[model samples]
Target chain A: MAVITVRQAISDALREEMERDENVFILGEEVGVWGGTYAVTRGFYDQFGEKRVRDTPIAESAIIGAAIGAAMTGLRPVAELMTINFAFSAMDHIVNEAPKLRYMFGGQFKVPMVIRAVGGGGRQLGATHSQTPDAVFAHFPGLKVVAPGTPEDAKGLLKAAIRSDDPVLFIEHATLYQWRGEVPEGDYVVPIGKSKVQRPGDAVTVVSYSKGLQLTMQAADALAKEGINIEVVDLRSLRPLDMDPVIESFKKTNRAVIVEEGWRSYGVGAEVAARLYEEAFDYIDAPIKRVAQKEVPLPYNRTLEQMALPQVADIIKAVKEVL
Target chain B: MKKEEYLELYRQMVLIRRTEERAAELYQQGKIGGFLHLYIGQEAVSTGLVAARQPQDRMITAYRDHGVAINVGLTAKEVMSELLGKATGMSKGKGGSMHMASVEKNFWGGHAIVGAHLPIAAGLALGDQYRGGDGVTICMFGDGATNIGYFHEGLNLSKVWDLPVLWVCENNQYGMGTAVERASAVSEIRQKAEGYGIPNERIEGMDVLEVKKAAEKALAYIREGNGPYFLEIMTYRFRGHSMGDPERYRESEEVDCWQKEDPIGVLHRWIVENKKATEEELKQIIADVEQEVEEAVEFAENSPEPAPEELFADIYAEEV
Candidate 1:
């Protein structure tokens, strides 16, 4: 086992995959020259050289669209957007092209590519920079969405995503780069569409992924000291939303609280809430509490930005409501 | 070009035109659903440009791609069946007129969105470049696509990376109903390529020989690893934008003015005047195309719809 930050874990996974397959290449703005906008690909350019580690112009749509084309051929391309905020420029190429191409072509081709989008607020990069639109991507079918909450899951899930014969929207939370954890060495593969019970308890079930899981974990730890015994189910995958653990957790606890970094209305948490209603209606003891970002364009002001996002206090408040 | 080449080019152009004409007829009969944007006047562009391409080269285009599909050797049966939404269609009836594709033929596929495939084509070129192959990627689009954001982006990357990609803009004059003059500040679509420093030229698409000559020069340049080239094939669509287009965008006299230079007619006249083929030989070429289209329509009509089980299948590659 190797202890590394999420950023290094991502780099390790990419490096390992590139070494394993000559066909795999990484391309994006500053992915080569600047080591990456977030430094996730810090040493990759020197190691992989220019052909494999490409620095593209600041063109989001072309970056993704070109990746799709390359993926459709033989190459396994991992395209990094500077941030998920910029992905809006390539929404059609992402939503319209990548997700549907496989099914639409009647399985003649596979878009075996990973679009790594680093997202979340708190950096105060302003309104456009802090948007968490992973939910928008998950709304479409034929696209696998994986959001890891730990350095371990980050390395494991990314390897799985690169090897899978489908398009994967690998969501990396911007704030989680410094998060350090034990990542297993050599050929660690985490299966997609499955959730893990990070902290098991019987009082209530808490569901979250990516940076939202950070808040959930803090809240769970605080409540545990107070003898609340809240169970934290870290939803590692969003699209093939691993309902098994969720249903199992709900059935055991009979109460639930959902947390997310995106808007509250019709968001990832809302989807989870609806699913629990349909599948495990009788298991719930109270209305599921949801702690999500307030419905407003994230502001430039740091204090207002913090107010817009879900805090650890918000998760605690939501969990208390269910308890 | 050789007589054999001229005849082959003439045959495919006639076949594309007639197939689209039949498709228009079927659209009126409600046999075909969805928007049908017939490439009637633009046959010479696909027929000549694609016919000049090497087998290893990748060819992809936008929604108006039936002509390219046929030119690239995807049978009319496959194209017609796809249009009819049958199980035996090119895309198993999953991708109707807009998204038809065949991987085996090196036709990457057609994208419904304008200018989206341009970048993908660049990606395909990058794939080939990485593999150490000399294959070029031919990305075809309508004139309206030049104004799209990705068009410039895709072109810029192709130039910067020095990838072998040919950007063929079939300037059929109108984007649905809006003409190139109204939608874009620069009337000439080729001017868009200047900012990217890509080698570009404009060709009269009404002459298949001119299109073929231009494609030959561009492909030669790309094969020598000279980077991407752009060719603005000045063409027009003889039909309405779609089957139900009101087409209030341009005057009838304007349509007639371009119609006088109808690509297939002009090609036929050239073949006759240049002694490429006799009148009877050209007539036989048209007859053969009619027969081929007839068989294709029959095949499409007889082809079965996808079974109910097929509806759930192909929705994903594996267990979600």
Candidate 2:
């Protein structure tokens, strides 16, 4: 067993895929010699040359649009957009072109592309860069939105996104890049649109994703100290959400709290909460509780920003309120 | 010039114009549904661009694509059937006017989003060069699409990659009723090519011969591995932007001014004056084209609507 950061896990996935397939290439701003803004592609340029480890202009729409074009003809392109906030520029190509091409053309063409963008709001990056847009992507049927929590799942799901015949929106948390876990050093792929149970308990179920999963685990730990056991379920895939594990956990616990760092209204938490009520309403002992970010623009001050987003204490408070 | 060749271009332009007119009529009837962008007067561009390319080459264009689809070997019957939402249509009635694609005919697609297909065409060119195939890509778009950010992005990539792509901009003077002058700084569409270091020329799009010659020159450069070239065909749209558009942007005199330079009329005049064909012979060809279009309409009307279950079928391909 070996410990690795989420950043290293992504690097391993890209390295393994690039070795596995000659067509798999990486293109983004500062992705090559700069090793990536977050070091996700460290030493990749030396290994893959300039063609595969391509450094592009600071044009998000061009980067994604070119990847869509390249992916359609041939080649499995993993395009990194620095941050998810920048994806607004490429939304037309991503939402209109990549997803609809296969269906619009009656399955004559498929856009095998992966758009990897850093997301979440914890580093005081402020309102512009600190959005969690899981709901926006999850609303689209053709796109598969994945946000993995642990290093192992990140590497596995990313490889899966690279190999998918359909376009996949793979989101990673910028703050979680340096966080570490044990990931096997070999060829492996995790199927998309599936969730995993991070920690199991019988008192209350906690559903979260990306950095939210980390907060859920910490809350589970803190709740364990108070003898209020909680099961933390990491929802790796937001679209085509696997309700089996989520429903099974809800049945075991009969009480649930969804933790998300996005705004409270019409967020991914709202979807999860609605789905839980629809599927396991009869099995629940109390109403579904949701812990999400405050409704205002995220403040830049460290203490205030920390308070704005959901934390372990927030999850604990929500759990106690529901109990 | 041979009478058949001259007549063919005239018939093609006529067919495109008539089909778009009929499409607009159907849009009013609410039969052929969803954004119906017509390519009424810009027929010479599609006919000439397709005529310039060989079978080995590929082509793709923006939403106003009924003309290009018909010119590039898709039967008018197939196009009309698609418009009618019939099961036997191209794309099995899934793609209407905007998303028509025939992979077998090397017709890549009819992308709805403006300037989106430019990079796709460039990539196809790259694939052709890599495979050592004697193929080039003809990417067509409206003048309004020229101002899009993807236009610059695609042109720059094509230049850097030295891809075999000919970016043809149909400068019809309006992008959905916003005049080219209102949206763009330098309304000379050819100058947009200079920004990406790609050579470009302006062609009188009302003449098929002129568009054909310009396309040949652009294709020659692309085929010779000189990277991408640009051709701006100054054209016009006789009708409103779509079926329901009020068309309050331009004056009636502007439409009358462009009608005098109609591509079909120019081709017909050339056929008669150059002694390529007699008046009687030209009328016979026109009659033949009209009959073909009428048959296409009948074929579309008689075709069956796609099954409700088919809505779920074309989302993904399943290997047998």
Q: Which candidate is the best by lDDT?
A: 1
Q: Which candidate ranks first by DockQ, i.e. highest?
A: 1
Global lDDT scores for all candidate models: 0.90, 0.84
The per-model DockQ list reads 0.75, 0.49
lDDT of 1 by residue, A1-323 (tens): 87999999998899999999998999999999799888888888899999999988889988998899899887899999989988899998888888888888888988899999999999888888899988989998888999999999999999999998888999999899999889887888999998999988989999999999988888888988889988899889998888889899999999999999999988999999999999999987999989899999999899999999999999888888887
Estimate the lDDT of model 2: 0.84
Question: Per-residue alpha-carbon lDDT of model 2 for B1-320, expressed as tens digits?
Answer: 56577778887887887777776677778778888888888888899989888898788998888988888878888988999888878888888878888888888899887787776676677557655677888899888888788888788877877878888889899989899899998899889899889998988898999898889888887788788889988999888888778988989998999999888888888878888888898787667777877888789889999889987774533220
lDDT of 1 by residue, B113-208 (tens): 888888889899988998999999999998888888888889999999999999999988888899899998888889888888998988889888
Q: Which stretches of candidate 2 lie over 4 Å from their true place?
A: B1-7, B119-134, B275-281, B316-320
What lDDT does candidate 1 reach at residue A225? 89
Clashing pairs in 1: none
Q: Candidate 1 has what TM-score?
A: 0.97
